[model samples]
Target: MPHFVLPVSEVLVVADGWQAEPDAEAVIHRAIATAAEIVEADLGEAELAIMLTDDAGMRTLNSNWRGIDKPTNVLSFPALPPTGPRGGDNAPRMLGDIAISYETTRNEADDEQKPFDHHLSHLAVHGFLHLIGYDHEKDDDAEAMEALEQEILAQLGIPDPYAERMD
Candidate 1:
């Protein structure tokens, strides 16, 4: 029941570095859908957008929105106030946008020695969690979020994404 909108901003190759996996969009779509399912999102009347871009595009977004002036792996913009009731029936809720930088994602994948698709899927889930108002800004929040992420990723037959970094 999850509905998604592919923007004119579908995918942007603004850098000359890494090439993406074959049918990359398909991988993203599947991951996003899986994340929504794991979060029990009311996807029947909700719409989400995912923008695949490079470091340059992401840097611009980061500078303009967060004032950080640097590229990060993913950025999430939630469309509605999380405390309020969702949109009415038949009105598709705008869940906001998730922008991912190919440069950062690929570089992190290489550094972590994880498969590109798996890493990308993890980022998508992370960003989706942010869209749903989940944040890791606190230790308790981090624990909850990480546990949910591990469970979700496991259901996808993916290995524990945080295991390598666990203390």
Candidate 2:
């Protein structure tokens, strides 16, 4: 089997609400690492940022970037490809930024009766997929993305997040 490389991820906890999940950062890191390995793309040496924020912060970001006035559980901002020459041979490529809302995630997890960390891992994996140009705007795309997410999560001992809807 071939070895896969994981990206360099930076987790920023910007909201006090995120403190409720003390293992949130570790969960994100583990999700991203597993995702990078499972994904077909070679993300070695790539970089990305994960921002843990509250609903208010998410609302502001969503409004400013997507023109959505409400808060979302997770949002991904993919970085544009570099247009110029590389600064160095070892420079890491910028993948993108992922922002997650604490309150929204908590609510969704509670409502779905799923473990908080499991849901958190799902969102992180979903956001990371977006950074790598995987989108679910279409039915086919959604299926493919969700399948991949299930595979990655399964490797992490997480159950299918879409199992309820499938039934």
Which one wins on lDDT?
2
lDDT (0 to 1) per candidate: 0.78, 0.95
Candidate 1: residue pairs that collide? none
Tens digit of per-residue lDDT, candidate 2, span 1-167 = 43766788999999999888999999999999888888858766799999999999999999999999999999999999989887778888999999999999999999999999999999999999999999999999999999999999999999999999876
In the range 1-167, model 1's lDDT, one tens digit per residue, is 53543221134434545354655567677776677667775544566778778899999999999999999999999886456665455466677888889889989999999988889888988988888889999999999999999988888788998898678
Off by over 4 Å in 1: 1-19, 82-89
Report residue 134 deviation for candidate 1 (angstroms): 0.6
Our tally of clashes for model 2 stands at 0
Candidate 2 local accuracy as lDDT?
Answer: 0.95
| Model 1: ten consecutive residues of lowest lDDT | 5-14
* Candidate 2 lowest-lDDT run of ten: 1-10
